[model samples]
Target: MELDFSNIKVVGFDADDTLWVNETYFREAEEKFAALLENYETKNKVDQELFKMEMNNLELYGYGIKGFMLSMIESAMELSNNNVPPETITEILNLGKEMITRPVELLQGVEEVLQKLARKYRLIVLTKGDLLDQERKLERSGLTRYFHHVEVLSDKKEENYKNLLDHLEIKTNEFLMIGNSLKSDVLPIMNIGAKAVHVPFHTTWAHEHIAPEEHDNSHLTLNTLSEILKYLE
Candidate 1:
């Protein structure tokens, strides 16, 4: 079914993977982490356990590199039966630091899409992660000038989006969200009477994956951020 965006006045963009590179770094870090613990567990097992650890600690730690770092440390301890070297723990800390300090790499056509859309729509960023990390990326992105507001959310659940839209006085009908994660960005926004566009990135975290049957084909899914121009611009 073809959906209408004619009434959409506010365009929300997801920061990680949508506008800039993110998941790829996490993948790379996971590889390094697996290698660090290869002696204690297979890479596959290490990856699985780490994801479980992150989920277990999500409520306590929230979402961010810090939480991921702690999860890695804990996973390493469990996988190694608490025999993992202290140096391995230090390496995990360094991995998180490296991710935080890495320069933001904007995805293809991000700036052009933002610039064009900003002219006619209220463009804002609605992303969930470490607040400071997101802010740092936005500042380094050099695209901050195009956005009217920047929000770093704790999570992207339906209520979170609803609350933010209400707080910003943006009517649900007038809001449109674009992002990489179908679970976080597309489904929840669509559920809350808002429009959503899925612009998939090359890599997705395991936690963000959803079964194909879970989504209906009502919303738009673009191959790249620039393709959105045909609909909105």
Candidate 2:
């Protein structure tokens, strides 16, 4: 079946893994975090516990390094039976601080794709995370010039997309979303009758993983962001 983007007048992009190196940092942080707790638990156990903590705390902390930092600290205390040293907590905080300050490394062909798409479509950034962090990353990415509007959502649920579209005065039929996470970016957009293109990042956070049954065939998936030009441009 052929999908059409001829009606798409607005294109939304996800910030993290779609446009730059994000999950890679979180992965690296997890490794470092696991290593820090190796004395009390195995690396694998530490990894599992940290992910559980993040999920449990998702509602309270939302997302981003600050929340992740808290999860790591709490996980360390639980995994170590509250016997974890103060220095270990400091190190965990440092890990997140390091991530927050790390330079934004744009994915391959991100700029090229955005540049080309911006000319024909009203480009916007629709990423969800800590507001300040996402804004900082966008500033650091230097790709903000290409987007007409930028929105940092708390989550990428269907309602979030619908409300944002309405606020922007963009019709559902005229909106297209491009992102790496099928769970966050593709599923919701498609559910709302908008088009979506999936460009998978090499590393995806576990939370972003969706069940096979939840997968919709209506959206397009590209191996690389650059390939989108073949269809959109």
RMSD of 2: 0.9
Once model 1 is optimally superposed onto the true structure by TM-score, how far is the C-alpha of residue 194 displaced, in angstroms? 0.9
**What's the distance in Å from true for residue 94, model 2?**
0.7
* Local distance difference test scores for all models: 0.94, 0.93
TM-score of each: 0.97, 0.98
Where in model 1 is the C-alpha error above 4 Å? none
The residue-level lDDT of candidate 1 at 14 comes to 95
Name the best candidate (by lDDT).
Answer: 1
lDDT (Cα) of model 2? 0.93
Q: What's model 1's overall lDDT?
A: 0.94
Clashes of 1: 0
Candidate 1 lDDT, tens digit per residue, 1-233? Answer: 36789999999999999999998999999999999998999999999999999999999999889899999999999999999999999999999999999999999899999989999999999999989888999999999999999999999999999999999999999999999999999999999999999998989888999999999878898899999999998
Candidate 2's displacement at residue 40, Å, is 0.4
